[model samples]
Target: MKFKTIVVVNDFSFVNGGAGQVAISSAIGLLAKGYRVILFTAVGPVDENLAKQGIEVVCLNQYDILHDPNRMRAIIQGVWNVKAKVVFEKLLRTLNRTETIIHFHAWSKGLSSSLFSVTKKQGFKTVVTLHDFFLYCPNGGFYDYPHNKICTKNPLGLSCIFCNCDARGYIQKIWRCIRQVIQNKMLYQIDGTLFLSISDLSTSIFKKYYPNKKALLFRVNNPVALLPLFERIHVENNNAYLFVARLSLEKGIDLFCEAVSQLGLEGYVLGDGYLLDTYKKKYPMIKFIGWVTGVEKENYIKMAKAFIFPSKWYETFGLSVAEMQSCGIPCIVPDKNAAAEQIIDGETGFIFQIGSLESLKDKIVCMEKMKMEDLARMSQQAFEYSLRENYSMETHLENITKLYDSNF
Candidate 1:
């Protein structure tokens, strides 16, 4: 490997979210290939899996932007953390920029944009995975939370700045705008920039507004944990429609609840969030299982007649939908997002109008009307499609290695 030293930078040491999990897994996979790897994080206690693998991890014990105890300090650090800069600079001092690669999976939550400034000054070979829209959009989702629709306004423009699209509030929106300004300035100063987008839509959306045309953009697959099975899982006997994601407005959980309740169908929701309690009370008919993982989550997947992903926002990639598909579960997703790419409409599953309650309900009814043989056939198709995509850890490593080789 030309770039023998890979330092994976993220906000958390553990699998806190999608980006964090990717960061941790990517590092571990790289180490398995015998690359000299280091995991640098801004939040701790470290993930036990990393420690078990004997990977070098540098944890800068700090709170995430939202959870930091001192509100004043959190606000200041969110923009540029002096401590993060100093610590990261120290780490860079020992590395040879020619052979070292600084790959950023996440930062906004804890590490801040200070680390980007180090990359700029040091001129190390760098790559950034567009896991979320935080680098460009102020609130990160590119969706107007107040209006509950996708926001088309260019980020940092007058309309975008004043629209109050942030989930928190307008003031937080202002702070995000400020952070973007600083982050942009730091990014422009660096050269030979590489951005690995999770999906084509994500790359297209990012290219529309991003000022740096010289920045190299490439689409890459995120390695999903589940793999396709040899024999198809029995889907005919499954009783309930499944919704597995955080219970939030952007996730389109309400739409799922509404569609399921309207049709009087059995439904299961297997995740927790701010809206969990509210949704549980509002729709008592739907089973709301809070945050099941491992075998418990797997059992829910096995029991699902069909999986639903009605994301209101422009999700770069839908992880859960792919995971369920790998388990031979047919998935019904909206046509707008990348998850729809995995589904073959009525064959593998169904594709409803994105964010439309009535359209979602219609699809649920259509799926319920599907004959047992058709349902089982679709399950086989879904599993075959997901498995054939080959989004395993080994394939991801091969793709990432190719990406690195091409960049250099």
Candidate 2:
């Protein structure tokens, strides 16, 4: 029953975003641990780093829902990807189910929940990481996109369906609801164990939906590679704050801009999205550096006074906050969601009331008034806290492997 190999499934082989990065990182870690790891993805050219690590990668060479040109086909595939089912069926036949664990990172983006039905029909034990609320909620963020508020209505309920929550419009909302039904059916057909990144919040929400008494749940925090102690403490802190995430509305980039403008403070954005050009034109004061990675992205964070995470949604886990903290950088997060959990208010960083520009500006103004020595103390505390609690790549590998071993 000991797992000798792990199959990590997601929608993309390339690191598209947080979920893809997590899946690829986990595969690389398994390879380093001398375990046979396979990266199974529906739409990808394949990540070179994973292939370089001597891990097997099977990419279907298709397009994700976002990239697919055919709208109808994309919508259908988003619900049920029959091609993925057939391909995975053949792959499942090759693996010894007892020695292999199929761990799914994401499916809603492209792969769809049809893969779960494949695993059940093939009689293989599987695990699913709650990367987002796609398995339970229609729009995947438990957010009412039209209203730009947190959604509390029950999924698929008449009230939920009656309300238009999709960012695209009412049509997309209906499509997402239909897709949710398909995902739910496939999810309930199998008894896969759950891996929750933020156990306190995500686990509870998931349990409310599924509530399978026999389901095994594990709290495995997403891994963040710790920077060296010298880099963590030695970075020169500038006067400006930094925001690093996709430049989207739900990400609260607009809110961050409004807060900075109110305080007459400088802010820098390090990621790109649909709203990049619009944000650039609307807020000429804030510098939008498009997107950055590796040392460049790290340097932006290191030079900033504080990392500002103003996401309006309830994040399952805020990986960027952990990364910033690991580098001895204080963070400003909303009082709600997982980002708040990463920082100790007024100590490691500050947490402001959600959706309040005055509260956000006040928090930033407070940080602006803090003395250099006080800031340094907070940064040191942030770094120490991250290293101790926020898991590293090594810790994550050990945790997931232990879960695999214990299950069987």
Candidate 3:
């Protein structure tokens, strides 16, 4: 079953972050199956790689509204004008109805929520992959601003004030609240919604918020095409620990820094973020290598004794943790969130209590005393687990195809 006129909507045309990369890869996979994919984004400077792969790119002119200084005014203009809806509808009109599927990935940046309504009204089957919490939360990740703490309450609840979660402004929050109300009304209009993680905890959260929606939900894990170069292998002696992710607050980088500083262990940071300058100054002992990609990322993972993931929020999935495990390096993740599902504590790596520096410090101290052979064994277990249960590109494609096929 070939979807000859498939449209993929996202924030960017190129694969940069995890969602961007997933979007590009999914398009490539679809193209390989002889599906004609039209990659749409609000902004472009299309990914050179996607162009090289022969995927068509479409940029919506409505993206400029996001750059406006008065964000609330811009959002008001965006919601009423339905610029994104018009653009998407115009494109859909050109395609044969039977051969098309509108697959939306991310819509927070510039694309207004009205696009979904327009598509549904046109009788087009739509599939929306839940890459993050943007559809339900104003801030996208359901993370509180400044503090970067996770909000557990249902976004639609009456008592749910948007103050802490609103990154734009009070007026913008009002705009978002109005937008979310519209989105909730249009929730059942979608043909399917795909979640990448299968944790029962996450499923329960989704169920609570979207109880009345009849949309089909499927658990399809993201695929890693290449075996990450850092797959755990037996190392005679390993001393450096690695942290590979955006150095953001919700990622618990501050907690990791504090714990490592207290433990006095030698560690390396392989990412860049807003907290870099502050953390660097505060902890002079730890090495910060900024951002890395390709072979450079692999080299860092290969050299690291273990990976540290101390995230305090409910991660939909931990790609870095899986990548590190693939490298044969054990991980020390917080017991909270999806890391608990990813890391087999004591067998593959250790799981410390969430947000507790003392728990993390104790785990680091315990790991520090382990024999090199024992560490290597744990790394082997991590590698075996990732290979057996995760890391398959085929699995992701098959699951996604099932969702698409089932709807048709």
Output the number of the lDDT-best candidate. 1
Residue 211 of model 3 has an lDDT of: 56
On residues 318-377, what C-alpha lDDT tens digit does candidate 3 reach at each position?
A: 777877777677889987577678888898999998778798888888788888778878
TM-score per prediction, in order, is 0.98, 0.96, 0.91
Candidate order by TM-score, decreasing, is 1, 2, 3
TM-score of 3: 0.91
On residues 340-398, what C-alpha lDDT tens digit does candidate 2 reach at each position? 88889989999998777788899988888888889888888998898679577788888
Better of 2 and 3 by lDDT: 2
Q: CA lDDT of each candidate?
A: 0.88, 0.83, 0.73
lDDT of 1: 0.88
Q: What lDDT is reached at residue 201 by model 3? A: 47
| Ten-residue region with minimum lDDT total, candidate 3 | 192-201
Which digits, one per residue and each the tens of the lDDT, describe model 1 over residues 1-408? Answer: 788899999999999888887889989999999888899888899999998998999999999889998999999999998889999999999999898889999999899888989998988988899999887898888899988998889889999888888888999899999999998888778788788988878888778878887678988899888833455678878888999888898899999999999899999999999999899999999999999887788777777898899899889899988888887888889987878888888899999999999999888888888889988999989888987988888988898888998887
When 1 and 2 are scored with lDDT, the better candidate is 1
Identify the leading candidate in terms of TM-score: 1
